[model samples]
Target: MDKKKISILNLAWILILTASLSFSGCRTDMQEASKTEEIFGTIVSVKAYGENAEEAVFAALEKAKELEKIFSLTISDSEINYVNQNAFKDAVKVSDEMFYLVCRADYFSRLSGGAFDYTIERLIDLWGIGNDWARVPKISEIEPLVGLHDYKNIVIDSQNHEIKFKTDTAMLNFGAIAKGYIADEMKSEILKHGVKSALLNLGGNVLAIGKKPDGSLWKIGIANPFNPSSNIAFVEVADCSVVTSGNYEKYFEEDGVRYHHILNPETGFPSKSGLAGTTVISPVSADCDALSTATFILGVEKSVKLIESLDGVEAIFISENGDITYTSGISKYHFKELN
Candidate 1:
């Protein structure tokens, strides 16, 4: 063969190889994998679409279980249980992850003016709304526990990674934000495995990682407080978290009076802020989770103002009268009202 003919043949072979590689890449990118597990007191699911989707989802689920062990108050040997049991007597050293979450919880506690409290475990136990024992307590029984709902009682030493309580009666519970925190951690784990698109639904708290495989935003539904079976609205989001706190979840009726789990730390009873539910959207899942509860307690006007003041935070407040009020930023996300 001539030299020119030989060079042309080599170029053709190179093109064929390149096309084969590109086609293989596309096939891997379209693959999807998902896994669901009951952990952290809720059903957590992780889904990913890409070459490493299965491994990423599995790893994320494992991470969620690890976090549950560290944060679960009911777990006998968990770090949180240790702190709750011994923090009052002596400063209990906690894991770095636990210390960071406690600090963040305290920050939000102060930010929401005690509306979102971590030191309300005593109050939660008294009401037992979502616990094995669910019932309404007498006024005298709830009144004493009211004073124990103070977040100020928590003493955190970031330098030493220790936590202590000022009062022996005080307890710590991350039930409000644990799922969100675990979801955020799982997102990190999924991305580390080279998953560019994923969705994590920790119970009702949803976090979308990057965009969908089709390059479209993820649509998350906001549950209707009055009718838990239906959605009141939907928000399109990407690389963000949508969290809702409502009276409809974990509530029981006694003598025609319904008592919910989202209690006011100040009152030791379910909040009566004239709001049915609050949904918050933010880049941080934990922040969205805490703010959802805070905004629900803050009511419509205050919650709207608070969300507006914070950068990259948006909220939807559904009133007891079935009216919806949302922040300006959420409008661009194409929020649709169903009812």
Candidate 2:
């Protein structure tokens, strides 16, 4: 065969092989996988579409479960439990991961001025709203613990990754922020396995990475505080998290009075912010989670002020009377209010 003709034939074969590989890549990019597990006191789910989707989803869930073990106070051997037990006695050395989360939680605690405090574990235990022991506590019992919710009570040594309590009564609980952190971590793990698109619902918190398989924004529903089974509105978002904290999430009625889990550290009682629920949208799940709780406690006027100062963040507040208020940034989300 002529040399030129042979070279041309080789080039043709290379082109054909390249096209075949490209087709396969496109197919795998659209493959879908999903998984769900109960963790962090809620049902968490991971859904992804891309290469290694199944393995990635599985690994992501496992990673979140591992994190839960570290954060769950109910877990006797959890790092948080250890810190609460010994932090008052001596500086408790903790993993860098735990230290980092503690730092983030502390930041929010200060930022919200105790509205989103993690040191309110004693109050949480006293109310026990989510457990069988849920009830209202006496003023004497509440008075001592409310002051402990101050973030300054927990001391952090960033250099050595150690934590200590300035007050012996202070306790640490990451329940408000850990789920969002786990969702962020799960998104990271899924990306490590080459998934380009994923959605994570860590309980009511929703996180979307990239866009839908068809390149549309993810639509997340904001729950109606008055109607827990229904949505009050919906927001379309991409590459962000939508987290909601509401009085309806956990509560019990006593003497026709409702007591919720989101206690105001200042009062040692459920926040009476006149807002039934607050939903926050941000690029980071942890931020959205913490902000939702804080803004809910801050009420509409203060929340709007706080959210406006933040970049790439938006919030929606549903008042106890079904009035809706939101930040100016929320308009960009294509928000639709349902009647």
Candidate 3:
């Protein structure tokens, strides 16, 4: 092995070197190393097609941690959390990145007609819908909290980078948009480091930044909402984002009814819309991710209109009963079946 080749810090480059060594008829025990990943409670597997892909994966993980630190509501000092925590106590100025995100959240809240809101955290915790043990909150308990979560009330002073809530009870949570942004940011940073291709499969939110090693399009799978483990369809594309928002994920059952995490801002409860899931494919995975949640909250009719208005974005809607609906663009890239 070339000592200089080993010094390449990018994992994608490293993997290529490994493969070339194998193809060149050289014998070396498969290089092995383990690095703990800090995002989503799972150690992300790093693979390389060229060289230094291990370093790229580790770098991605590092980037994910930085995002986590900035966005975590659990942390008292994170700008978003700090603003929410300090609301009605004292005004706190935020960083420009934090300021922009707060502004973006506000804009999306308005764009989606308040369907996409960050202040739904109180209701989320009350129902425990995202957690393993789910509990139902009484209407009495939720009614008061729902009144507090008006996204229009999130006042952003862009010039000063300060944000404040109109109501004392309102708090912020970035469950919908944070992961997609992290993936998108990681992709940009990875590319800047000279990697031409990288695939990030964050649970089901998949983004392919570059072409495959064979110079073909990247093939990504869309998980069936009906069955979490299996995919209902596959999409072949390069440099696109495929994000799914489903009623099946993060849900709980009580008696005979099932409750899921995606909530209606109006009612502060699981949206009763008939759609099962919605996938939005765009150049921006982060936007697709956030809009998927927003579109689901908007229901089928409104979501269809939203997708149509956006350029270069395609969509697929999966109904609660497994009816598949496709926009013009996604129809072209659809995979017929799996072997």
Candidate 1 displacement at residue 245 in angstroms: 0.8
State, as a TM-score between 0 and 1, how close model 3 is to the true structure: 0.84
Candidate 1 displacement at residue 206 in angstroms: 0.3
- Residue range 41-93, candidate 1, lDDT tens digits: 78888889987899999999999899999998778899888888898999999
What digit string (tens of lDDT, one per residue) describes model 3 on residues 1-339? 586666765676879988897877643333322344547532343333445556776777788878777887656666666667786576678766566666667777777877888767677767877666678888898888774546866777777777777776667777887777778877876776667777876656887878777799888878788886898888898888888999888888888888888988788889877888888898887788888899888877888887888788888888887777777666665644443
Off by over 4 Å in 3: 1-38, 41-48, 147-149, 332-339
Clashes (backbone N, CA, C under 3 Å), per candidate, total 0, 0, 16
Q: In model 1, what is the error at residue 269, expressed in angstroms?
A: 0.6
Question: Model 1: residues >4 Å from true position, as ranges?
Answer: 1-29, 147-149
Candidate 3 has an lDDT of 0.74
Error of 3 at 193 (Å): 0.9
